[model samples]
Target: MRHATTSDGVRIAYQIEGQGPPLVLLSGQANDHHWWDGVRNDFHSAHSTLTLDYRGTGESDKPDQPYSTAGFAQDVIAVLDELGIDRADIYGTSMGGRVAQHLAARYPDRVGALVLGCTSPGGTHGIERDNEVRKSLAQPQPAARQALLELMYTPAWLATHQGPYNTLGDPDMPAYAKRRHLAASNQHDAWDILPDIAAPTLVLHGTDDRFNPAANAPLLAQRIPFASMHLIPGARHAYFEEFRAIASPLALDFLATARQR
Candidate 1:
């Protein structure tokens, strides 16, 4: 593990492994780098994968202050700069996808290819998750955890596999930090800047994604110029893990093809 000091003096914790072109894997809301542990190895053969804990999670320092997706992008930039990575393929899921939109739009030269999974474009243009889902999330303790598990995976997948899934996010994060993380992701609005992205892009989502909703996938793909969209059949919000056999290879191929172009 290594640390990158952000402009605001927050220490961002990151890890890099494997070989080939650099690929940054950004996790969802309140999650640390461990969110990608299940699928990180799947891309190692094709790309050097980097994962980081956002300011509020994992080993990163969490200050009592506001957070923004733009700020989160800066955290990523600081890490890349610390590692001397000029450009990389980006794979961001949920809240991380929101951060990737800002990164790709604001730092086009720093991105080679982009992959956004189970995320929204945000603002009024974006589709919000239903009230029922929100209510389930608001529930206390074990109930909320169970709701999250059900939301992240399909019934068939859950029935077939027993998992600790890493869906609970950072258990050690302070409530304030978690709230800050939520606020940062909630405030993300990149619709006006989507066209600014210069990288070849792939927007991925599970057809059955209840957390972010699959309807947002095509919207993101359509807004980003030359971006393509893929929906994994029967998977949920954690499609990258639930369907890595399809998602990982497709992203690697897209990144490889983009590099050759």
Candidate 2:
């Protein structure tokens, strides 16, 4: 793992693989760079993929201060700057998608094409998850694992796959950092900044997503100028994993097409 020091003195951990144009991958809330493990190879075939641990997770420094999606965007910028990369295509899922919104808006020239999956805009305008889904997320320990699995995948997927399937994200994260991550995600409000994103954007989500809800995908697409939207049928919150066979190809194609244009 390589490291970058943010202006605030926080150390960010990141890894790079394959070769070609840079493609930065951002994981969801409380998740580390490993969140993209299942699909990294597919992307690597066409791009030099960069995955980073958000400040509150993985090998990055976890300061006691508050976190925000905007702050997370800065962490990404620091990494890109450290590597001498002027611009990169970005693929972010869930909370990472929220961070990408800020990155593209706040630092437009640093980002090229963009892909956002299974994410919400947050705040009053965005769709909120169902109360039961929120309750499942609030559960503790072992129970939280099951709750998350159910929320992440469809019932059909759960019934067929069986065996071990975990979705609780960054098991090694400290309790304090986890709480701060949750708070940062909850406090994210990118609705006003969507139009400011200059990157060619594609918005993707599962038709049956209950975690961030599929409705938000269209909202994102509509708000971000010229952005396109795709909803994978029957997939849930973790569509990038559960339906990677479909999702990854779409993202890769979009990024490639955007690069050509």
Candidate 3:
């Protein structure tokens, strides 16, 4: 039930868990703070975890305007500021990674460490989802979930995360909000800003990611002077959630002791 208002007057909803160094969790497009439900607890035991619903999703107010990556970053800063946090580790997934990049780049002093998972740097250098994946995404929830699982998790891990066994968030974003989110995601470009990031960063990717493609991982590591890359074999885009047993610990270790520039 916690909330913070952006400088633009938009109210953003957020959740807090754990108790140590602050670690903010930024989810990908079309989802809310609940999106992190599957994996956020992994960091709760070691760090104070903060998960916020974007202005257009979950319990947050959704304005009918174009959403931008920079805007999302600013929202992050607002949350930190409201909580009286000076600096903390930030972890983002997919489109959230794009926002995290801009957050670290634009507000360097506010981020101590960064983790980018299953994301792209955007611009002309980034890869796009193939037509087939795009088609699957447009299907009804039943079929769409099935299609998404194929790209999100390894075949063997699928059963544990799909159907009645699923534990993901039921993001309440409206159609308009979804479109705004997609528009922002489409326009996200962190290529130029990446080199300016001063916080130590970890670029984590799944080898089987079809949404953003694993090839973009090295590009992120190479672009940010203080970034390193990790590619998990037999994993896919939703590794952080589906494979938290592995991915979450790696993230904790990196943000736990990863040297900051």
Candidate 4:
């Protein structure tokens, strides 16, 4: 594990692995760096990977204010700057995808390539979910996890992996962790800036994703000039878990191609 100090003096924790060109991994909402555990080894073998906790999650320092997508983007840029990396390929999922879009728009020169997974442009068709789930997220802990799990995974997956599902039922996470994550995620609206992304991009989503509809992928791909969309069938919002065998290789291939170009 390594550390970098952002301009605001918050210490961000990150892990660097593998060999070859550099690639940064940005995780989804409410998930720390460990969320990439399923595919990190595969990605590491192909590229030098950097995974970090976004301010409040994992082992990183969590401050009280300024937990917005734009702030998270600055934190990412700070990591790259501290590492002395002029440019890098960035892979972001859900909220991290929103950060990637912001980075590409605000600091285009620092991004070599981009990958967005299970995310939206944050417009009319962007955030679709049950009212109960939203209300639960705004409530408290443990219960928030229950509400989240309902929206994150499909019913079939929950039924099949009951033991593991139960394990994730009440994660040992802090309330402020959830608060900061939600604050950073809820206000994102990037639909207006899609056409400005100049880097080669890949947008991947699951056909069965209910949280952020799969149709949003095509909308993002259509807007970004140099972008392509891929849909994984029978996979839910957590498609990497539902179809790890397929999603892992596809992600690796997308990163590989993006790096080459």
Give the TM-scores of the predictions, in the order they appear. 0.98, 0.96, 0.94, 0.88
Query: Measured by TM-score, how close is model 2 to the native structure?
Result: 0.96
The lDDT for every candidate, in the order shown, is 0.92, 0.91, 0.86, 0.80
Clashing pairs in 2: none
lDDT of 2 at 186: 96
Summing lDDT over every window of 10 consecutive residues in candidate 1, give the lowest-scoring window: 161-170
Count of backbone collisions in candidate 4? 0
Q: Per-residue alpha-carbon lDDT of model 3 for 10-116, expressed as tens digits?
A: 99998899899899999888778776876777898789899888888888899999999899999999989999999989999998899999999999999889999
In model 1, what is the error at residue 260, expressed in angstroms? 1.0
Model 1: runs farther than 4 Å from truth?
A: none
Q: Over all chains combined, what TM-score does candidate 3 have?
A: 0.94
List, residue by residue over 189-256, the lDDT tens digit for candidate 2.
99989999878999999998988899999999999996999999999988998898999999999998
Give the per-residue lDDT digits (tens) of candidate 1, residues 1-261. Answer: 999998878899999999999999999999999899888998988889999999989999989899999999999999999999999899999999999999999999999899999999999999999999999989998899889999998888889979768766888999999999999988989999999998899999999998998999999999999799999998899999888899989888888898899
**Backbone N/Cα/C clashes per model:** 0, 0, 0, 0
Residue 121 lDDT in candidate 2: 88
Q: Cα miss at 139, model 2 (Å)?
A: 3.4
Model 4: residues >4 Å from true position, as ranges? 124-127, 132-147, 159-173
Candidate 3 minimal-lDDT segment of 10 residues = 161-170
107 Cα displacement, candidate 3 (Å): 0.1
